[model samples]
Target: MSVESVVAAPVAKKVPVEREHHGDVFIDEYEWLREKQDPEVLAHLAAENAYTEAQTAHLQGLREKIFDEIKSRTQETDLSVPLRIGDYWYYSRSFEGKQYGASCRCPIDAEAVGIDAWTPPQLEVGAEIPGEEVLLDVNALAEGHEFISIGTVAPSRDGQLLAYSFDVLGDERYTLRFKDLRTGELLADEIVGTTGGATWSHDGTHVFYQTVNEAWRPDTVWRHRLGTERAEDVKVFHEPDERYWVGISTTRSEKYLIIGLHSKITSEQWLLDSATPEGEFQVILPRREGVEYSVEHAVIGGEDRFLILHNDVVDGVKAENFVLCEAPVADPSRMTQLIGHSDDVRLEDIDAFRDYLVLSYRREALPRVAVWPLTESGYGERRELDFDLELFSAGAGSSPEWEQPTLRIGLTSFLTPMRIYDYVPATGALLLRKEAPVLGGYDPDEYVQQRDWAIAGDGTRIPISLVWKKDAVAEGPKPLLLYGYGSYESPIDPYFSVARLSLLERGMVYAVAHVRGGGEMGRLWYEQGKLLSKKNTFTDFIDCARHLIDTGVTAADRMVADGGSAGGLLMGAVANMAPELFRGILTSVPFVDPLTSILDEDLPLTVIEWDEWGNPVADKEVYEYIKSYSPYENVAAKDYPAILAITGLNDTRVLYVEPAKWVAKLRDTKTGDSQLLLKTEMSAGHGGVSGRYEKWKEIAFEFAWLLDTVGLSGE
Candidate 1:
């Protein structure tokens, strides 16, 4: 038999399951695919994988070429700029052929000025630093495992003990482990199913971490002593509400341990003095519905004050744009507005220092940082750090020490490589520490980046970031891949990617659509595209693609689109709404069966997602509204753009069954002969596959397939 005949796609056996919601009846033929562990389901997924490999067999060389191009552009052996925290200057280094890096630290020079004074060692890429202590060799730990991810690498305050968390299966449920850094020996204590973030107490005798529930939500915080068994760990706090997930962290100054409970629309924080490790935590502020706030401990005017960034009513004014407020630690409810709320500026975060307060906010849809110097009496004038790049991203980096005089700032754009800067507040100078080493002599001037706006159906302007090589001239409409993820209020900001160079070098354009569901334009932008307004997210994406076609950037026949997770929902909706706009679609871990998934509140993360997506089980209107656009329910007898849905077996965020059922339905329902492929990573979870080399190869495969779909593989 021929190889093609041996790898033909499997036809899924359908046992139609009739589901009723809001008095509406629906017949789902592929519902049986949700039985993930069933032998038949596994066989079907395996068949799909074999079929994907067979269909793309011709593009194996192209995939390798793309992977090599990515490798050639990246600096395989590199060292990150050291960040000073406490008495050590810490950094991670990647070896030439290693899949992971080594986290190491070196003692500060004894001749430094102040008690908190430290200077980063200036070392060559391959040169070794003096007194370098390897804290964790991830490459060594990753050996013999198909998937390994190091979640948290936190060294204790005294730098004697290291609390690290790692996941071996890509399931995100990490195992918390400890090591005696001085002796280079592993501790016997091991805690499983942790969220991975370990917060150390001031004396370093205890570490606090959160444990994940059955639904994979971190809901309980536990404190484990250095020499105690995991079973003896004390439950410091437990959040009974399923919607609110919990996390624990210590203040930068190591003064207090914070237990944060977060839901979709509400948040509550509890504080425990690091000095009193066993003491009960006190609530910083009680939780209020529809109000969100974060607390930062700051010492001002000889008194410790809580600097809060919140969206609560202030002076009878609705805090639409978040306001920075100061509240006495004793009386947290009594807030004094420090920086009054403005319609244009949205306060995002506040990082407190011993002598200054760094405010990160958004103005004009771009991130801006302002430094407020602390005086004996009060705060002085706020000075904003200016950047020359018009379309770039800049924010605070690893400023670990609370008393440091310099702020580590990270800057990059679509065309620029990642650059690290040390901003000296006193001199107001942005000293360039290091720019990511791009192998083969890369120049930022060889690329062009621009910003354009697409008018949405409702007259809302959606931002689009475009980047391409300067020499890749477009005489006519070219192959363009537009990407978007417009959920969770997360901003899809412009970033530099060495692998993206392969596409741009091959005369392909890459654009990111900042649709309304994201926080790109502030909180209002996200509000208008979620819940009942969710359809706007799909429409906004469609509008952006139409605008690109109208502007002659790419024709409908040459364009491809992509989104992952919630954004995958957008991809599915667009495929149903405007399939003719693109030649291909890439949906990664897609949340396609929203109506069915949301209706089953017992499913993982379903209850928590009620705020982002309305509670379809309780509200009939929500059920009907969601059913109208749910990708799996909406698939009909029409031509769909060639689809490539990628998923993993152990994904808790969005089950692999979503894409599995989605592909089965698409294959059975769609009229056109366009490709419908599903590639399931049997050993991996939501992240698809682990290991740096494997990740690069996966991207190469996807890019090769995309290039082939648009007839650009030969180019």
Candidate 2:
């Protein structure tokens, strides 16, 4: 990542002139673009403008209908009660013998329910703190109406002092609270109206935290001396600029603190020595110019050297590898690559136990954990920890094996919820701490997970994951939904899809296209699939459809592609490349105007994201490359498939206006009237339709769309 010598100190860059035509890779002139008026295009634009105006009412109606439907579908199931820890289970919050406080996601049976303890080798009913579940009739952890999960259970190193955070609305203004676990008494919460950002000092005698100050955007850090008599005793550590984000990484050593400052993407790492939280923060690494990689995070141990996780791409194509820099407290020597590059071995998690480097990664889309003795050169004699590592196109919410370098692991997959185990590297002994119990009547046999390789027209072998019921027809042109995302070196690994399972059981085939740009197959896969060469992603998706159809899995008419955000970008690009190859298209929050976005730097996250998209502004070659396929501009009035475009009003990353305008041109240009409907979340941000029930309803709506579009439905 090369930093341009000029920093945007004074309004940084010019406010990019809002382009008249999106997808215009290159234009003769901005003035000419704004001035040129083809009546035919303007006429099409007029009809679209009118339709968009009419949709103001239709969109309102749809919002009300969706909200009503969601509300009606929700509140149908009697929420589960929080259970106590016992032979079957106990609330972690209630388990006394457990080192940490017992907490569980069990349904609350009654209001103000209590937590109960449970041990596999069942503990005897002794004078230990009696485990019980005091169920709450209402959502105890409700986001707004009730208590929210403020910050993580901030307990002391000794599990004595506990600090936590909670908030109401999505505005993220949180309230910090501290409690003495032994006495169950409240302690001073130095920062009252705070968002989720707080950490404890190694000694547990002092607290370091940050809160959004005067500005609504940037934040400030503070340190609170524990056992203080006055609230005014807390000291302010540092105030970050509007463009920079400030955060603290607490280490076991009380002498050092890792201060992270970033303007979102380009980051600066600093180490500070604080007498109290109010101490000065000196610059450790004064903006490593042109070096842009997210600070993987650090383990503060002997000498307090930090192991940084950086996706150092040589030409900003595919992410290079994770590098470990031995920055002892104040020493930030250029850096060293602890682990070398691997298209397969993604540097997932680098954890430091008492003395080992627990390297958790995904190999060939399979979950793997490697243990190494921590050395200056990085891990040694890496031992692999094994479990089921399936690759679905979707992501896995469950974590992987290994609590840390201590040779302990906690593995969980989409299909397999959670499992805790202890491993001895020296003797190869594996001990199971806890195996996740099957809940919600989940059965793997109800469906299947399979991977197939499809070769594109250009000899590119693409991986496609097919998940459906075991008895699902092998030859039938089933109503199928294909998905893919190929950007930012993100790998869409194998993970269970509960919503997809619900659909697959109804005879619909769910497929994930492992195209280029994504770390699906590994480095080569990602490298071949990015930037100007990104056309491979579109062609590969088309190949996936053709291959599946040719193999008798499904015909063209039965294939429906779905992608959101970057995937949405994939969906739109694929639609343009092969419009008739699929039955329907769901492009949610898409970046349809990739060229325009890169050309215009005013867009939020655009300037910083140039590293990911390639600087078309500085580099003419990249500019021409992006302009060639910019989805919005290239959309000609052609016979196209049914397109459903969804966005959000408050999405700063991909503004609702992009979708609004894209759909406008799409509706006007499409040779056929493929139902082009736009749905916007009036309030939500990137993660749309949050909340368990709300999320489920949104899934149901999508399922309805695909079913309706492809003539397949469970109901």
Give all candidate RMSDs, comma-separated. Answer: 1.4, 10.6
lDDT of 2 by residue, 1-715 (tens): 1123222111111123434333442332222112114454334333433443343332343334444544442223221222222122223332222111333223223333211121122223232433333321124445245213335545555555667665544345666667775576777554566647667765677777776655433356667777675365454455444456677874433445667777634667665653354556666656654444434334433345556666555445535544444444446555655666665576655655444655666666555677666555444577776554554221222222122222435554445444556566555677565544443566766666778889989886788887787775455677788888887667766554445555665678888887888875655566677766788878888888889889888887888998888888888888888888888898777887777666666555565556566787778778777777777767887888887776654555665556655665676567875767666654555556444555655666666666667776423
Cα error, residue 156 of model 1, in Å, equals 0.4
- In terms of lDDT, the best-performing candidate is 1
Candidate 1's residue-wise lDDT over 353-376, tens digit each?
998989998876678888889999
The residue-level lDDT of candidate 1 at 384 comes to 93
What C-alpha lDDT values do all the predictions have?
A: 0.89, 0.58
Supply candidate 1's per-residue lDDT for 626. Answer: 92
Q: How far does residue 331 in candidate 2 sit from its true spot (Å)?
A: 4.9
Pairs with steric clashes in candidate 1: none
